[model samples]
Target chain A: MSMGRRLPVYLLLDTSGSMSGEPIEAVRQGIKALLSDLMSEPTARETVYLSVITFSSSAQQIVPLTELMSFQEPSLDANGSTAFGDALKVLEQCMDREVVKATSTTQKGDWKPLVFIMTDGQPTDSWESVADHIKQKKLGNVIACAAGPGADENMLKKVTELVVKLNSLQPEALKAFFKWVSDSIKTTSQSVAQVAADTPIGLPKPDPNNMIIVL
Target chain B: MNTEKATLKDGRTIEFVHDQPRSGTMKEVYFTPDRKSVVCFYKDPCAGSDANRLQRLQMILGAYNPTLPQSHGGAAQNDIEADYYRKLFCWPTGIVVQPRFGLVTPAYPSNFFFPTGPVWLKGEEKNGMWFIGPKNRKWFEKNQPSELGSLIQHFSLCLQIARAVARLHNAGLAHSDLSHNNVLIDPSKGMSIIIDIDSLVVEGLFPPDVLGTKGYIAPEVLSTIQLDLKDPKRKNPNARTDQHALAAFFYWYLLGRHPLDGRRIPPGNTAEEQDLLAFGSQAIFCEHPSDSSNRPEEKQYVPCSALGPLLYDLFIRAFVKSLHSPSDRPTALEWVRGFVKTWDLLIPCSNSSCLHKWFVFHNSTDIRCPFCGTRFKGTIPFLKLRAESRPGQWAMDGQLAVYNQLPIFKWHIYSRVFPSPETDRTRQAYCVFHEGKWFLVNEKLTSLTSPGGNRVPPGQAVELKDGAQIRFSQEHNGRIAEVQMIRS
Candidate 1:
């Protein structure tokens, strides 16, 4: 089969000390659920390439851009203070190195990446400069999720216009969040051709009882 | 599992599993306790509030339905006719008003689901995407070859799809969103069934529920998609759009590639903008006769012309002349006719290990299988059919390639008896090969005559010699078959 254009998806997760115990385990199950959901979808498996960036005292790309069929769930542990700035920097570097740009000569490039960020605590690192750069450049369809009351919605709003909030860091809430994320990606990949320029791809509404969209 | 009962609009009660419902963009579906039907409630809170939508559902479940007999308030005439069409579509049965605005539809036939496979694929709905999409095809070829049928079976499934669409069009209806997601096909059994029948466009009764799915949306619809939904200039999903989608689907099934997706990049900065133009305003047939710019860079790609002249002409009209001009596109009935004619031209591949297993006997001196590049050997016979244009003048109608044990139908014996849901499918005659010679045995034909003007009664055989003309029937519009032999 001829290689087709890709839809890159980035998951930036805050593995701060605040995200231990139930929260950490839920995130692990969430990633597992996401992988299985995407792999089972024909369209997503064909077009979506996934990557994971974890941030604690430092940020690292636990999984580089990889096809859905070949994607491996990474082991996640929560420990250090949230390094939100470092995570954003790592996401930027990965997008720069991975996302293919359309050229007049070659085949069509990869679609604009979809970045999902989840955090349960306030950033311990200086993130304003990088967040402003991402906002000004319109880097991608960046959606930041404030996983608990401790996370700052204002800070997330500064990073990306699209923000959602979970009232609690319960395992059930995290599971629902990830399921919704998987559904969004599946829908995006399935109807990628129908979305026009400038219009953000529509995502399935999350369970209102568990999550809320932050305007 | 716990179950909940919901009252239908017709004062009937149906119980559904009260477990986590499987969600679609617009609805959440729950299986009935018996698992024979599904109750799908629209997620939109306003859906139940819209009286117009409820009325449309009533019309869909009653008057316009093709899968039920007229006695059941459906369009089909009788139970037999209804049963025949019932296999072609999964039509909505009733409206659920108590719980919410929803529909009751029969669960898809078991064959539409994967019986067994890798854990993730087991019991998954067999969407046409798995068969037509190149990447999915590769996955099936590697993971489960049994899931993929031969090329001839694919053609049979396409014919079934054409027949299903024709039935809808005949009733002045349009499958608004005719795409992979809305249709399920069982190529291994040469079967196809259209689902989501509730969304059908019923000609002036109600508007289309959706524009269409990506890759299957009509070029005109996609090109004008930027317009407001109610804008007069915006083309919506109608019968003509269904025709375009049907053509695209047929091409994909036969050629294993999309008709419009090629390497050409439209002028746009964002991927969405580029796709909008690529599949819409700037769309080009990848195999355009005069334009090589958009042709796919695939090695060993079998061109659409390999499908034989009838289908080749249809493909040209579909993608070249009518890609944007909706009115000029071939109708669903026309596709059925094309497939019917092409069905007679199929021949089994000589290579035992050929992936396609069969290939169309195209009109060329070099006969070969396109998939395996296997050359056919030995002599083959063709029956050039002719109908009486005048009192005694014979006009060429069509031809059928002969193979051992090929059963001839009424359509082959009588030029006027075209195959359809209501047509007789019993064999009228049959062909056989014995001792290096071919013979045509009369089965049900009462007035069968040999090339030598001798009566060939039922159960008797006539030698099919080169240049021999056999009269299949003496009745009006009966066909005469002239034999032609070719050595490869």
Candidate 2:
């Protein structure tokens, strides 16, 4: 496959009854910062677009593929059950749309879209159907991360390319994780803008001085 | 967009307020945003909103400029440190911004506890803002050991202290006021980062007058003339100034006290042989000096000797040069190589192969180990890509790109780059490229099979409908020759 030049990222967040207080608020604020970071890079802003997906009893797309300056913050409320399965289906569908957009157009060498999934509780619905497609990387690169209290690491494994445990179920962990996500997106966008498809550019490693990365 | 809550395949929820600008700095800064750039200045500790502003300032300033030390802008290309403050402030909000420029203070206020000292960090989105100074005495009083033996025994923590100072020097600025209090510690990480940069001396306009704490200061500043920090023309703020502080800090980092002829630092200073002796030994309050030999002692100070000689060498250099003049001192660039070589000694890691085992030079393409060919981690590409695009198709002919994302390796398909079909029952999947349509044949996967419900078991064989039109276009030199999408 010809390498893609741009990266479209979607951050899927879980804001349910359990994630009400600080945890949910932290996610909202974190996404704002992440988008802002993406916007600041002149090259990245021009090439990459960001989206947000929040799931509770049902999954919702809070933001579409909007550029940073035009992108608005997503207000989140914590209520109802965690319908993780539904959220996955929505994410896969959204990714399909974005990928299809890339392919249909003459756009060449754009990166496979990235989906970041963050959560903090057990699923109230079965995710078997959606999970199977993701494990096969059906849409693109799906990275599902778990944060805060009650996140089912074992279950999250099904949805993620990698799983991480927060040292605490507090705001800092999610904040740090999002920061990492923001930085990673920034780095990737910058690399694609400057290098060939076959060069070597690695992402920032876990700063031992800061957050820990869970395998 | 009306903010909404969401969940993943694996259940979890988060609450939040999206897109609002949280520009109020994190409780310790004051800045004035302008059209050209964001200019911020740091002052002494503030009480309320001012404090938050400074806190935000602390989170935002960074050191990734390759041209700081007059090194070609080549270095900055490799080390792209994020404007962390932007991330910190943006966290919870996800409004990341870039900082284009910066400046730091180089001296401590006369009255350390007085209302406020000042610093300024210049950036693109914002300008210089005020910052607060440190409370070294209060911090030391609460943390350090009273007994000489205990302080000396736990001296290893000082390596972090030295590295903290080195970081400032690496940024191409001199820490004019190198007092213990000017350094702040993140209690959680157990390492310190320099603060109170109100008097930081930029290397570009340097070598300024000698700055920093009296106890930590090299004898040249004391023996020569006290720097007029306001007078921006002194040469004392050279790398030598930071180097002196580094050597002295190393001694303190190990022995837990300043090497002196009493509580009062010997007036004789670097010119004195005794001060040189103390430095040579890497001892401050204790009689025992760093022994070059001995496994337990050597290993404990970080068994790896890759950097021991450098740190040990600096102590001697400071002892001799910090005497009557600043001219004889080593430069920050020189010391960057020194500490960088000996980085492991300062912060010893439990894992011998850990990246933290030593400070790794960055901004390179292939990272062959300095000793062995084992690749180092986090190296970014340096070659600039030719900016060429033919409408929607960017022609990236001569430039290099990095596939940082690991290739997708599945049961039937080993990898996208190099695929050899085979299948384990659990991971069986058939990829059909008939009529030019790519699809994955799925079966139901078990809860034990997926990560956070990210995957499902293959069930009944079914043709998938992914809801998309594929248009693969072959091109030569930015010209799209053909396009195809035949979904059967």
Candidate 3:
């Protein structure tokens, strides 16, 4: 029989001027740790395909959708302004090219994608229309995290119902967020493996002790 | 992170460790201090009716507990009986009423979660029933003697599941959510454990709270879900639906594909609609005998015929005839009988790399291993048994290919010896084809007589020859089988 359907996970990071030093470094290290943890899980390794997208002056597909074993941590030199609109457009394009649609002739298709958007500052460019377009397309379940005090929750809320506000972009707090992401991905991948791809995916409960506020 | 303690009806107090409760969609499972048992606290408070159902289930379990065996009458035998039920099921042992509504059950052995030694290093764990999917076969490929080592092992596993479900059904309980997710399979051990017993439907006392997992739900149940909840025609999961799930489990275990998942059906406008059609009103068996439209892609899967015609017929009855009619579905007992008969017909494949290392004997002029497509290079030995269902009456039950080290169960020897854990160890004998001769090795049985009328005692061997009659036991109802040698 054919291998299990692939679940594409997109990580959209805001590598803007505000996220220069520690924040960008934390994002890089967090993704590396997530990849390592996912690789250790056989189910996740087999079914989860991950991608990395970064937006500063413009959005770029730093890493295309690939298996965890082949995933490489992309270096983010934070600069310019947060082009969130460009990021959404790039995400839509990547999904269009990368996601495999289910068909009648062949039931082979990628599972519904899970998107994680982490931003430390407010969007400098108009992103509402593009975000609305992608949400209407029903491409995936988007969870937007507003990292640090400068990030706007109202803007993030426009894109997805699942939104979290990190108190600060500290290494420990970022680690906790990434850990939650890893746990959620593991749980979702396992759920997909057990039931149909369209079955509601259960997200992991956030750590109450870790100051990552659920908004 | 303080642990809360609750007292059960039996005066036993269980401390629930709330610090790291494993949460699911409906409940959060916490372990006791001793780690011997777990308490599942439902996220939502149980309704009065739900509590009544739990009480009824407890009563039912108490009644089903086996009495101490007279042969070994002691606390030890009682403990053995308790362990027997525990091994057969992850049955709830007690009810918890403290921090939240919950019930307690024995913790699954650690081996149920992960393999030992090198396999753990490879990050392979039991990981629930998904491991048994055809695509996940590669996970166990590295293990010695592959998980799908032979058709006999698959038959044994399926029979074990059937017996467990049959026992539950006989007790008037139905596993509402019977699916791969609720079952755990250890392929290396060829064993399975049914979990989520809390959701069991007790006739007249309780109704099913959940319909079932998607693919395993009966077509009739799915098709009628849109009707009003109070409608009499609205089908709820019950014994009949359990039969459908049981049949699906057997098919998937043996064939590695869902019985209703075929390419012939058109995709619906929505995924939910597709599910409703594919597994419901428009469902069709992928391997329906008369229709090849829904058959699996030849390059990806072997036909269900690999299990032999006896089992294939049962699949047809289950998925073809019973797709729309619940009454037409084969019962668990019927599946058990079919598996036992098909198991007897298997012959070892000559190719070592073949995933299924055995295939059913076709009795054709040219015998080929259906699994690896390899032809037999030597003469094959067949054992034709005469089944005496009654005194002074005998009939040709069947013929079995004598593969090396093929097991001989009690049912094959004695018509009365049924298959169960109690008789499992005592009823085994084996056939060995070695050194250009075939012999029956008496392992546990005491009675074996050769054609010359000399007794072959337990642990002795008797050469099998053409037309040789061998009595398996000296009892009044003992069965004697005739040997038939064929050269092609």
- Ranking, lDDT, top scorer first: 1, 3, 2
Q: Which residue window of length 10 is worst by lDDT in model 2 chain B? A: B126-135
Tell me which of candidates 1 and 3 scores higher on DockQ: 1
lDDT of 3 by residue, B49-135 (tens): 466656665654465432223243311145555456467567777776665557788777655565443432343435434455443
- Supply DockQ values for each candidate: 0.52, 0.01, 0.20
Cα RMSDs of all predictions?
Answer: 1.7, 31.0, 4.4
Residue B171 displacement (Å), model 3: 1.1
True contacts kept of each: 0.45, 0.00, 0.01
Write model 1 residue lDDT over B1-488, tens digit each, in one string. Answer: 89999889989999999998878878999999999999999999899888778888887777878778899799888887888888888988888887787888999999999998877788888888778777788988787776788877887788888988998898888988988888898877778889888778877887887888878888898888889887999888999999999998898777888888877778888677777887888889989999877787675688998889889999999999999889999999999999899889988899987768888997568999888899999777899999998998999898899988889999998888898778899999999989999999989999999988989999999988889999999999999999998778
Instruction: Give TM-score, chain B, model 1.
Output: 0.97
Local accuracy by lDDT, each model: 0.86, 0.42, 0.74
- Which candidate should be chosen as best, given TM-score against the real structure? 1
Q: Which candidate, 2 or 3, would have the higher DockQ against the true structure?
A: 3
Report interface Cα RMSD per prediction.
Answer: 3.1, 25.3, 5.3
Model 1 lDDT at residue A119: 94
Model 2 residue B445 CA deviation (Å) reads 88
Error of 3 at A15 (Å): 2.7
